[model samples]
Target: MSYIKAGTDVNGNDVKLHYIDQGQGSPIVLIHGWPATYEMWEYQLAELPKHGHRVIAYTRRGFGNSSKTWEGNDYDTLADDLNAVLETLDLQDVTLVGFSMGGGEVARYMSRYNGARVSKVAFVSAVTPFLLKTDDNPDGADKSVFDDMVDGIRKDRFDFLQSFGKKFFGVGVISHPVSQATLDWMQSICQLASPRATEQCVYAFAATDFRQDLATLKVPTLVIHGSSDDTVPAKVSGERMTQYVSHAQFVEYSGAPHGLFVTEKERLNRDILAFAAGGTVEGTADRY
Candidate 1:
């Protein structure tokens, strides 16, 4: 793992993103979500290379050990940072995978960067299409919901994260398949993120609309969500995402929670490998 200067953001703040590249063959750049770093994809990092696929995971600005810039927590800059990573490496025919807030980065990358050098995209327990409720977005969440989240995070980031982590993994909210140690592990990683960045990102992912970005995605796409997701519910996110992307395959992990990547590692890994190999994906997936 190395930290490379990814160039300054729009605000002229110099930012260095931490990233690691491994294995050979086509590249797969995995983007993580709010309050998380590239390390969030540790499982993929360890396994994908063994299967003949290069795995590249990077920490976004303000997350993990990356430079914590005060400005630019929205999707536009986040997406730009991701594009910069792939461009720096001159990687092509790449499969971009984004989880949670990273899903917004994937959409923005396609629309903002024109999907240059990108062949495929994937969303795992993502937040996409439109998350906030407005006059036009009737199915989205209430304004107060997001407002309260930002308030709570600003008030006490650590405490708020402690509560958010439960819903994130669906511990008591649903039947989560992880031990307390696993939950603690996730929290430790989250604690590494800058509190301000974490707070601002709640607004970025919750309020930003990616409907147009979804339309811009022309390549093959994969959507995976836990049926019992509580953080970003399947009902609001992946379920509707299947309708947005042009050529997309959807996977639902029954009884799995928001952190299905941990709760259902074996199954999730199999699906990821199959998709990366360009194998025929079932048009639709029944619950796991």
Candidate 2:
């Protein structure tokens, strides 16, 4: 990683985009989810470069070291902000990857904007197709659950985020190999995020229906899910997304939780590289 060059968006409001540019092949733009910064993909930057692919991961507004925005925080605005970042950098022949809420960002882009610069798409533990249960989506979580989440945010966002962090790992109260230091680091990152923006994002995640948007995607897409993900279950969210995405490949990680990116980074990274490098590989859950 080198000193990040600053860039401005269409709003002329300095949108702090930090990047680690390496390798000399097609670019891979990584979009992270709620309460996480570009640092989440730190595991990828060093490796992907050695593999001959450019990896660009940046902090979205109101997260990490990026400029905090209290203005509008919605999916459309978030998508436009990303578009600005991509356009300003003049990135082409790119592979867009998104995880969790980041997946919502990817789906929104594919649906609204013409993917002129993007060649491939990957969704790792993405929330898409639909997250809220309605007349059409009986499988989704009840609307009240989202409403309760919003209420929790309203009461005490900091504690809410802290508690949410535990559920994010889905390991429950039991212990894991990942040290307390690592867990604290992740929690600190989530805690640093602006509560106002993060709360709005919760609504964005719960309310927005990406089914229609996903149906419009023609680009080669990979949908990766963990079987034991409690935050956003594989069957309801990811599995449903595949039905909408034309020609999308599905991969399931057995007993892998939502934090598969962190818990199973090596295998996830390998899968991503193989798919992007024009190599044939299986998409099912197999221990690396």
Candidate 3:
């Protein structure tokens, strides 16, 4: 039930972010993807601590137990919320990990804050560089795709989430990476978020360009993406990220989906542990 005040909303009411701080060592801040709470890092929270790394994950302003605010769902405010966590905890030499939409926070935070308090970063199935396809960014997803997402949310939020969760974890008739109960649990977590925040964040992650922000990453970086990710294609985000941060170590989870955090948790944990410890990650370069 620990909380950190992330400024205030339009009504000047304090926007408190519920967070989980556990373990003790060099810190790792875990940012959950869209439509999820800090609870999404349940596996990491348990495993990372066993390895002696302090892990912190927080619910975003409009999600979970955090204050449901009408504003501040943008990347700028989201990055500031991350800053609040780092500052409040007085963490140093940290490894910041962002997944899916959470990756935008890591990218924006580095650029906006000049990489303060962090020595390394990792993007797992992230939405970065840019997601919305423009005339200049032909490799990005078409705007209509995101438009449909927003429309779906508006028309039937819960139904959309139920469907989205399946695609997220690569759960289909022939391929069930996660159980039905797991999907149910995830949907429950998504329901904890404010509908306004959920809808607004779609626009944020869809349209926000992080190309300039990627240029600001001077720290050690790791990029992991599933080759089968349909949510945020690696070709668009993770693959393009290495072009920006040329020194980043990239790993492609062969046949993995966007929800590799769950489907490939053991491998993901190993890679993260290796990278955080400054050890060589056992993987080949991008093989596409």
* Candidate 3: clashing pairs of residues: none
Residue-pair clashes per candidate, as listed?
Answer: 0, 0, 0
The TM-score obtained by model 3 is 0.98
lDDT (tens digit, per residue) of candidate 2 on 173-214: 574635566678787887777877777788888889988888
Off by over 4 Å in 2: 1-12, 175-177, 285-288
Q: Give the per-residue lDDT of model 3 (tens digit) for 41-113.
A: 8888889988989989999899999999988889999999999999998999999999999999999999999
Evaluation by TM-score, superior candidate among 1 and 3:
3
Q: For model 2, what is the C-alpha lDDT against the true structure?
A: 0.78
Comparison by lDDT, 2 against 3, better one: 3
Candidate 3: lDDT over CA atoms? 0.92
- TM-score of candidate 2 relative to the true fold: 0.90
Ten-residue stretch with the least lDDT total in model 2: 1-10
- Best-to-worst order by TM-score is 3, 1, 2
Per-model TM-score on C-alpha atoms: 0.94, 0.90, 0.98
Give the per-residue lDDT of model 1 (tens digit) for 172-272. Answer: 74455667887778888999999879888989999999999998888888899888888888899898886777567788888778877777777777788
Top candidate on lDDT is: 3
